[model samples]
Target chain A: METILKVKNLKKYFGRVKAIDGVSFEVEKGEILGFLGPNGAGKTTTIRCLLDFIRPSNGEIEIFGYSSRNPDFYKSRSKIGYLIAGSNLVEQWTGYDHLSYQEALHGESKIKNELIKKFSFDPKPKVKNLSTGNRQKLGLIMTLMSEPEFLVMDEPTASLDPILQEEFYKIIRKLSSEGVTVFMSSHNLAEVEKVCSKVAMIKSGKLITVQKISALEGKKIHSVKITFSEKVSKDLLVDKNTEIQEEIPNGFELSVKGEMDAFIKKIAKLKIESISIMQANLEEIFLEFYKK
Target chain B: MIAIIKRALRDRFIPFISYSIGGIVLVWMYIALLPSVQQSQVQLQDVMKAMPEGLMKALGVSGVNLASLEALLAMKQYNMIWPLLMIFFIVSFAGGMIAGEVENRTIEIVLSSAKSRAKIFFSKYLSGIIYLILFVVATTLCAIPMAKLYGYEYAAPNYYTLMYLSLCFGLAVYGLSILFSSLFSSRGKVYGISGILFVAMYVLFILVSLKDSLKNLQYISFFYYYNINDALIHNKIDGLSVFVFLSIGLIASLLALIIFLDRDFAV
Candidate 1:
């Protein structure tokens, strides 16, 4: 796949406070990169640098193969679409007026009506009167209207209702299938796990790890459920190969990593009534990464 | 760029009409009542003598030859209220241009469009210029019949110098305000800083005209170059004054565009 966006050693500092400290990542074409981080972890700041709205204190960026630091970068950036987190649109104008104003500059919107209907919305009401979900829907319409090839959204689903969130997932899935590149940040781990093929974990303004969900799934980690016929001491059950995940009544849920054959044989020798094994899910792996 | 102009024009339509009509009527009212005031010239002069010096100076009464229609108009409208009205309009427009979007968080939407920051800045500035030009033209045209009816003997204004100087003054004020707008995200701060600076500068001009000690500070105030009264009444172009205002305006505008190019929209 072609690299649609690349950031090398990106850094941003505000008066000695490092907002983004040497963060680096690359996003491939037709891929949805889920940027996951805790609040104030430089997600939005990094997005701003990518969009060229703010200059990075150091490092380089290339979007669609053009250096973002160049003077004429915006000539290429105009094709980018974005939905700002917690955007406060003009209150006096109707939703239609706002959309029309944006469309007038960006040209026609391909999915205007479809998205509007899907959201079950009319753009007639004053923006201030619209509920948060409706306002987010309006912003989504504006962002997706131009049918842009590259999209960067910050917390896109935070304000969306569950049904709209599902619809949003479907829309992004369809867009990605059509070869659009998306780089989005969100706190919704489930949504990210559902839609994003690769998740980039950010912590303290640094890129900690970037892993594919399927690749993480292939790790030799399994959830072992065992019901003991008699009480088993925690110290005896836990070895160098396995960690007790949770303690149940007369049972223990253990996470057995690779080379657990010896651990399993030892477990069978104990008072074990029945044992069940299941693959570790993405959520469990994500939690491990997130907590780190 | 086209979108910016289109939206700006649409938003300013009603305001343009209100200001243009308000200007015409105001100019006409002052011109229409000139003869009666002229008749009371002797009494007015006597009353002026008894008034406080500061009040008279604020009204620009000290420099005017009360016997002439041009001087009377200058004292009452041109030098005082006309510029005040223009400043009111330009101040609001400039203060709101960039900062208003930041305040309302609409800039992210606009910036995400195909246009660059420079294009957006220039588009909005161009719209303001077009409005200012059209406004000046409307008021100039509207004043013809009123001047003829009230003061047929009033000296003809130097149209060439007047238009250039007025535009330059408008540009200067608007440019300064835009500079302030570019520096801050809050529209209220823009309004507050620009408005206070405008008044403070004008007050400095008053001191230059009235106090010997403060006369040297005239070069710093925009009002010093905005001598529309002398330009119209005395036929004095004051090329230096025009250059000063135009230079300040152009420099300020350029600074604003450059600063905003990389300024982060924190929200």
Candidate 2:
């Protein structure tokens, strides 16, 4: 895959605080990458540096193979759509006015009406009158309407309701299908799991891991429940590899990691009647990653 | 650059209209009432006596023939009306420009556009110049009829020079205020710093007029650039003062643009 954005030893300082320290990552074209971190973990700082709104104290950023430090680097930025962490809109203008101004700035004057209606925003009402959800929708419309090659959003779904959140994911998925690269920083693990093919975990301005979703799937913990026709001996079931989490009268629940084929064969030899396996949820995977 | 100017013009039309119209009406009323006050012997001397010596000096009223109708009109229009209007409009408009964008978080959207910081700064300054020119033109139009009614000779030459000096001084104040706007991200801070600086300079002008010991401070105030008596009544332009004020405005605007280009948009 072609690289769309490249960062080398990116760092940012706020007064005495090191907001981003030696962070490096690459976003590939046509990839939906998730940037996962806790609050105040330098997600927004990295995005700001990428957009060239803030200069990096030390490091380099290359967007579409152009240096971000150049004064004319902003020309490349016009091809990018960004929704910052907070909803920042001119309160005096209507949602339509904001979008129109953005459109004019991008030189995309003939945006389709269907595109505007997709977000379900009332263009007539001023931004101050809109709720947080509606305001976010307005930001979403502004970012998505240009149909740029890359979408850089920070916590894009934070203020959105569950239904709107799903709708937003649909749009993101559509964009990904159309080969637009998306780099979104979010704490919502479930949302990330739904669309992102790759995930990068950050903690305290440092990158912890960057792995494919398939690699993370293997690391997922599964809860296996087995029922035997007869009572199973606890001593025989005791194994260091597979943890026997709980023991019932006729069944046992075990939390297994890695490949469970051998563990399932062991259960098969024990005259099992019914067996059920459930993978760990996204939140559980996030917590387990953090715990490491 | 044109786009930026267009945006500024659309956004600032209301404030421009309010200040210009209010200025013209106020000056016209003052000019018309001056004749009536002059005809009544009691009102003229009483008004002159009540005017404090410090106030007269602060307003730059000295060595002028007050007996002439044109001189009194020049004093009222140039000393009082022009400065007040110029200070209020430029300070208020410029104080809100950058600080307001930061407060509203619109700077992010603006900077994210295709335009550079230099372009944005130039466009904003251009818009200020346009507003100031429009004000000068409007005030001239309003004063023409009143100048004729008052039987003031050489009214054209007097008001023309007055307008020129006013424009130059107005640009200086606007440039200073724009510099203040770029330095501070908060609206209150910009307004406070700019207002205090203006008042302090005016106070220095007053002090310099009071004691010969403080005369050295007169060079600091932009107000010193204009000799209302010479410019308005005698139609004499001080080339050196104009050069000083223009240089200050140009240098200040250039510094402001450089600072804006380097500083990050806080929003």
Candidate 3:
């Protein structure tokens, strides 16, 4: 796939605070790249820099093959749809009014009705009267209606109800299927894992890792619960790969980090009646990554 | 640029109407009260004594004879009322121009569009000028009947000249406020600084009018542009004052545009 966005050593500072520090990443065409980071970990700052909302203190960003230094660099932004972290619609205007204003700005009148229906938003209600979920839906509609090539959303599903969240993912998936590149930032690992084929983890303004979802599946750690016939001696369970996570009267739980074959065989030899192994979920993976 | 002007008009039309009507009413009421004060046969000195110094200063009373109805009207209404209205409308309009977008977080969306920041600034400033013209026209129309009712035969030329001077005053204040709006990101700061600058200039104009020693300071105040004593009462427009006022607006607007083009917007 061709690279859609290339960010290298992107750094931004506000006075003494380094908002984005040496962050590097690339987004490929037709790829849903998930940007996962905790609060204040530079996700929003990175998106802002990408959108040219704020100038970077150091480093470079090239979007659609144009360097940010070019005077016409912002023209490339027209191809990207953005939903900033917070909902900032005018309170006095109805949803329809706001959408119409934005449509006028873009000089497009084709997608109004389609987007209104797609997001299931009530156009009659004022923005101040709309609930958080509906407000997010309005923002989503505005961004989506632009028919942009890439969607750069900062915590797009935040403040959304579970049902709306599901609906949003469905829309995102639909867009991805249509060959629109999506760069979504979120703190929810499961949300990103559900929609993204590839994920990059950022921590404290620094990128920790960028890996494919399939690669992470292979790296999955599992917990094994073994029920032995008798009390297993400490000598019998002498394996460094499997660490005891929990101890019971008749059984013990072990977290297997590496290969599970040798540990499973050892448990079988110990006259274990039953054993259960479950793959660690995304939440656990995030915790482990942060713990390290 | 047209789009920006349309948006500004849509947003500020209500405030513009309210202020324009309020100005007309205030001027009419002040004129009506003047006849009553005159019917009571109160001494001019007594009337002046009844008014506080702060009230006179705030009302921009200076140089004109209070005995003549036209001079009284010029001092009480034309001299300060239009200037106050011009400053209020321009400052309030300008205070909200860029700062309102920042407050609403819509600046990002606007900046992301095909239009450049300079275009946006110029368009909004031009819209402010349109509103200012509307305000001067509204006041001029309302003042015509009031002038006839008071039997002031010279009101036509004076009112026309005052409207022209108000336009110049509005342009200077509008440009100043736009400069303030671009310099500060916060709405409160923009309003506060612009308000203080306006009042400070008015005070300086008064000081220059009160003392010959301080008369040179008139060059510094935008209020000098609409000096009714020289323009309406004396029936002579100070070409120097008009030139200075227009130059200030041109320089300030250019500065605002330059700063707007280069200044980084907060996300």
The C-alpha TM-scores of every prediction are: 0.90, 0.87, 0.86
Which fraction of the native contacts appears in each prediction? 0.70, 0.54, 0.44
TM-score, chain B only, every model?
0.90, 0.90, 0.86
Stretches of candidate 3 off by over 4 Å are A84-86, A224-277, B31-42, B45-63, B67-70, B145-151, B205-220, B224-226
- Stretches of candidate 2 exceeding 4 Å from the true structure: A84-87, A220-279, B41-55, B67-70, B149-154
Among these predictions, the greatest lDDT belongs to 1
lDDT of 2 by residue, B94-213 (tens): 867787777666777777776777877788878888998898778755676776776654367767787787777777887888888887777788778877888888778777777779
Best by TM-score: 1
DockQ computed for model 1 against the true two-chain complex using alpha carbons:
0.58
Say which candidate scores most in DockQ.
Answer: 1
Alpha carbon lDDT of residue B184, candidate 2? 73
Per-residue lDDT of model 3, residues A172-278, tens digit only: 88888988999999888889889898898888888888888778767757887878887787557657666687887688887777777877677766777778899
Q: Residue B28 of model 1: what lDDT?
A: 80
Interface root mean square deviation per prediction: 1.7, 1.6, 1.8
Question: What does candidate 1's lDDT look like per residue over B1-267, in tens digits?
Answer: 888998887877778788878877887887777778879899989988987685576566765668765667667766767787788777677767788887777777777776878888898888888888887766644555667775556655554456667777888888888888888888889888887888898889877666878878978888777776666666787888878888888999899998898788764
Docking class of 3: acceptable
Q: Give the TM-score ranking, best first.
A: 1, 2, 3
Global lDDT scores for all candidate models:
0.80, 0.78, 0.77
